[model samples]
Target: MALSVGDATLAALAGVAIRRKPARSGAVHRTGAPVLRDSVEAGTFEEAFFAVPAKGETDRLLHVARKTLDAARRLRRDARLGAKILTTSERVIARLTGSAVRVYEEILTLARLNRGRVFPSYDYLADATGLGRATIGRALAILEAIGFLVRQRRFNRVAGQGPGPRYEQTSNAYRPLLPERVLSYLPRWLRPAPLPEDEVQRYADREADTRYMLKSLSCRELAEATVSGSLGKILAKLGAAVDRREREAQIDPQPLTDSYNKAQTVLA
Candidate 1:
């Protein structure tokens, strides 16, 4: 018998089991059932589960789904484009100085976090990016010199007037540079073949559906449930859109032009 969506969802939530065939080759393989795949499938199925709701809830679900799908589609497009740019930048930096590529990524991560108002201390960044504190400090200095980061000093008059310095991006620094980087640096082998627009649209639709399922819950409840469940990653992805927009607004147009010019020179 075919299971209803609700039934399948509940069973998945309760933890379904699947049998795995043993591998052969004279290897001492441990015989045991794998549960990770079932768990993942269950999570995916749960995101699609929606119980019959009151009159207006169906329309609300559809609206949220549409918005989520739109955001997801744009995200996928941006990510693919961004990856291409970064790959190209990596190759250019690698050729210049083998170590520069990693430093460049560190700068990018810092810039991303800054957009989210998440300024990590030197120690925090050193631990997170696995770069030495001195290296991270040097990279931050370079980023500021290159117009990727701007240091602002604010005085806290209420608290004895001490000077506090914070880093900020010049303005759309990443977005334009990313597209240029993708077009210039992507080695032919590493470039993903162009995906059909229809396939991209399908992914967008699926993302939207998943988002609608989450949106059905109240915001506070959803936050609590997400922390306790497997939906944290999804929530994080959804939240990134806001940060991306803020970063785009602050990106400096001139550096992007310079980065594009530099990329063209490297490609040439």
Candidate 2:
């Protein structure tokens, strides 16, 4: 099939190499070595190709994406779209090709299943969208370039375990975004909500509490103080358990030597 203008734009935005096959060279034949494909391959996108996004940025993006997804879902059900006139969200959806819409809808469905977090693998997306992995990649690139999605590369920490690499690439984390241009067309209810004032205060309070508990008080002082909440009880119990373990260690300072002595006594 011919590549659409939108697909070309998406390819450029994603840095995807969408080109015709290069001509075989006589020098390559003389070398007699296999020519490796440098283009992006399905399921071969590894962690080393991209840096992991910051946790705070991912969190912020995911929050906005969640709101956008919610609004998109609600907009789909609006009766205005069924009529000759289209709602803003409907118009946005209409702009995408039918195949692109299918791929996008499948992604949104998966995100909804994961509580607005897109955690599915490319294979999973292919199975869900009934499209090849390459096609899905192109579709994702399109959505991301249009400011309708944010794709973050993620990795699993192997921690020097029996492995070739310390970290391995995992499925990307996708967050849907509301394009800035489209935001003007959306109604107040359909638009992404601002962060609540209390959320900031609550986060600050939590940080302050953590700092006070961790830095202000020493271990002994914290253990001895009679704190009023469940957190206090948990800490107190943990301290007691640790103390008991230390005392037990002290009681049997040389367990191996003591065991050897007891064995000699029994033999004697």
Which candidate's lDDT is highest?
2
TM-score of every model versus the real structure: 0.25, 0.35
Q: Which of the numbered candidates is closest to the native, going by highest TM-score?
A: 2
lDDT of 1 by residue, 1-268 (tens): 6777887787798786332343233332233322222122222222223122344433332233233334334445655677533343343222222122344444344444443232345676677678888876675554444332333321111222335432221211121012222232334443346789999999999999989988875544465456534466566555566556656777844477888999999999
Question: Lowest summed lDDT over 10 consecutive residues: which window, candidate 1?
Answer: 169-178
Give me candidate 1's TM-score against the actual structure: 0.25
lDDT of 2 by residue, 104-213 (tens): 66656655555555657889878877889888877777567557776765445345545344434467766655578556545576555777999989999999997788
For model 1, the stretches where C-alpha displacement exceeds 4 angstroms are: 1-98, 102-133, 140-183, 225-268
In the predicted model 2, the residue pairs found to clash are: none
